[model samples]
Target: MTTQTLDGVTVNTQANVYFDGKCVSHGIALADGTKKSVGVILPSTLTFNTGAPEIMECVAGSCEYKLDGTDNWVKSTPGEKFSIPGNSKFDIRVTESYHYICHFA
Candidate 1:
């Protein structure tokens, strides 16, 4: 898959902070007005609560995650994606720095 750049989109550079600064993301709006974030996670375990459903695409590296109400952890690598439901929380563990694109729906 190819990554599309959102022209004329204003990015929120200080949004979506997690793990006390270990994980951070910037918000961007698509041409159709869909919101998303491109972020990087450091090697750490973090839990995040979502207000809307999210599809996280692994752009570089990999990470393991367990969704809310799920006991099994799943691994996602570059080009792989995982979905999380709205109003839910999920845990993620990363060994190395992981880069991802988060699409909010």
Candidate 2:
């Protein structure tokens, strides 16, 4: 694992980075043991499945997402966030490089 101190909090990066060509993310464990991921999604439309509830905070660029059971796509930009339920799927479309921090709980 790799470790880095951000804003005085040390985060331990998981050894296996998650990627599927369109997006890449590194899992991190916060000092308080919270699991999270910081990642960039390349310009593409992708579907993702989650095992736990997630709160995604956008840090750069923007993205449009349609949550499970929703037909409308919500737009989110920097400083914005969206939540997804556990054991569900969501679709996201990014026009540019989108950076985000995902908090898993």
Candidate 3:
């Protein structure tokens, strides 16, 4: 199921803007020290590189992502998720606003 809320989280007020404001996110930390990010992607196509493995969970809307070394674009919607490896890159395409929570794995 999609995560609707997070309790007892310490949020960073600063926004992380990317792709010239096509994407924006806020970092959050749970009581257990688990870090995550909540964000939205506007209509655009962008490539992102990862320093750590991540699980991108879609809480609303949708996006199609193509992982490095692959040609297939997988669609992720509410309650769905995709994984990306560390040191790898992925291409994401969105036609509308896509809301997500990024989980580090």
Candidate 4:
């Protein structure tokens, strides 16, 4: 697997899931109204400026995130997806190293 940084965030990707020997990070939209899929490996902590404005699921690892800077962390573990509005400033604290596949519309 290889780890790369995007927008100041680190993401690790498995080498097998690539195309033409290039790392597969972003995807194209299909005619069936489906956009694409992206895989990410989050570390212990991550801070972001904007994100999806909807309920997102966490397939692996747990995350401690908060929409506001109140020291309150929203726990997001395996089988749990949290709702986060877009354009909301937030910070993510992963209790354990985690990996997830995120789908975009």
Candidate 5:
């Protein structure tokens, strides 16, 4: 199911801007100390490198992502998710907007 709300999270007010502000996100910490990020990507193709494993969950809109070393571009819509390994990178293309939550693992 889609995560419509994050009930108990301490959010960082300052946004993490990337790709010349084409992508932006706010980091949030849950009660149990689980860190996550909620963000939106504008219309652009961006490459992101991960230091830790991450699961990208789409909450609204959609995106097409190509994982490192992969030839296919997979579509992620609302309620869908994709995983990226630690120390890896992924390419994402957004035509409209992609609202997502990044779950750290």
Candidate 6:
């Protein structure tokens, strides 16, 4: 479904799942308290994990992310999945409107 936001941004949400399914843009699934989304032009900032491990799969486009703000920035693209460790902070910047599936486990 295409959910219309007050800001005029349109997002499609499908198959809300508790453990496994497709993700949406900035929508928090009630089944899991984690945030899952296909980000667009994600600004450079720190992503701090506060719970269990989260899974991110690069479906399209690319991203340059740095782990712990110390590790070098790495380029990730399609068919790649990165595990974000819990309690660690990572910085990310999207070169385009990349599609990603983030599973908060």
Q: Could you give candidate 3's per-residue lDDT for residues 1-105 as a string of tens digits?
A: 889998999999999999999999999999999999999999999999999999999999999999999999999999999999999999999997899999998
Runs in model 1 lying further than 4 Å from the true structure:
1-8
For each candidate, give its TM-score against the true structure: 0.88, 0.84, 0.98, 0.56, 0.98, 0.56
44 in model 5: Cα distance from truth in Å? 0.4
Q: Tens-digit lDDT track for model 1 on 1-105? A: 535454777688677887787898899887678888999999999898999999999888889999999999999998899999999999999998889999886
Which segments of model 3 are wrong by more than 4 Å?
Answer: none
Model 3, residue 70: distance off in Å is 0.4
Better of 4 and 5 by TM-score: 5
**lDDT-based ranking, best first?**
5, 3, 1, 2, 6, 4
In candidate 1, how many Å is residue 1 off? Answer: 4.2
Clashes of 4: 1
Evaluate residue 14 in candidate 1 and report its C-alpha lDDT on the 0 to 100 scale: 70
Worst 10 residues of 2 by lDDT: 1-10
Clashing pairs in 2: none
Question: Which candidate, 2 or 4, would have the higher TM-score against the true structure?
Answer: 2
lDDT pick, better of 1 and 2: 1
**lDDT (Cα, tens digit) per residue for candidate 5, span 1-105:** 788999889999999999999999999999999999999999999999999999999999999999999999999999999999999999999997999999998
Which wins on TM-score, candidate 3 or candidate 4? 3
Q: List the residue pairs that clash in candidate 4.
A: 53-86
**Each model's number of backbone clashes?**
0, 0, 0, 1, 0, 0
